[model samples]
Target: MHIRVYNTTNAFTSLGATFDERVLLGRGPTSSTIHGELRHRVGSLLPQQGNDASYAQLYIYDPASALEVRNCRNQQLRRDVLQTIQDTLLQVNPFVEKFR
Candidate 1:
């Protein structure tokens, strides 16, 4: 999994230097949250935004590692990972809307 945060408001870009190639946003025994290494990464930006910014966008790149059948028999692991991500996002930004 990898993510990128784009701040249309420019407030998030004001943060200091760039982020490392891989910052652990969150992790579980069978899942890991990865993000792109950029001047302003999602991990750093989210804390600064504080769930207030209405224009921030997150681009998630799932490598499908957890979805591999051999790695995740019955697909339960994949579902767990997806649920983890959803729960994490909602927890971080309660204002986020869910459309399924």
Candidate 2:
């Protein structure tokens, strides 16, 4: 399972980074609470902004190696992770391109 969100807001990217760190540091509201023992990656595709681009792409996914050991528990965890990501997106309201 994977997601590629374009034009993501800085808040969303920052939250993702924080979540990953919390998962590592065992502090704060880590998404791992909903999905235990699952390997996932969620971060900005471009850490550095370009000359004219203010937004970035957010990538979220479980690595292929992790997928090899997939089971019912893993499937449920993936679903929960997706739900969490969707909720964050709804709050941040990113990926909305404006047209003039």
Candidate 3:
């Protein structure tokens, strides 16, 4: 699936730029167990501030993949990643704005 967030934070944008695709392999509390594989993409407008955006693409085996993300076996890491995605999305969220 796909998601687009606008007016994201700097940290979010930075994290997005460096976000690792391996996170999709979320192994839960299993410590780097990696359940599956996925990808992500966070972008920005050509203009300036207030026009930044972010996006995340996931490739789960099935809808059940939620099980890995939702009730993750690893609580801390899962919480950290989830929180980062949430907080950042709100910060420098990506969108379809035209930069000048």
Which candidate leads the pack in TM-score?
Answer: 1
RMSD of each candidate? 14.4, 13.2, 14.8
**TM-score of predicted model 3?**
0.21
What tens digits encode model 1's per-residue C-alpha lDDT throughout 1-100?
A: 2222212221223343443434444464543333444264444323244442222232121224322321233332345554565455545653443311
lDDT of 3 by residue, 1-100 (tens): 1122212211223232333456556565432223345433344323246531222211111223422433243343444455555445435544311110
- TM-score-wise, the better of 1 and 3 is 1
Q: After superposition, how far is residue 49 of candidate 3 from its true place, in Å?
A: 38
The candidate, 1 or 2, that scores higher on TM-score is 1
Candidate 2 structure quality by residue, lDDT tens digits, 1-100? 2332312222223332222334556555535433334433444454455422222332222222222332222343454454554456545554522110
Candidates arranged by lDDT, highest first:
2, 1, 3
RMSD of 3: 14.8
lDDT against true structure, model 2:
0.34
- Model 1 worst lDDT window (10 residues): 3-12
Q: State residue 83's C-alpha deviation in candidate 1, in Å.
A: 0.4
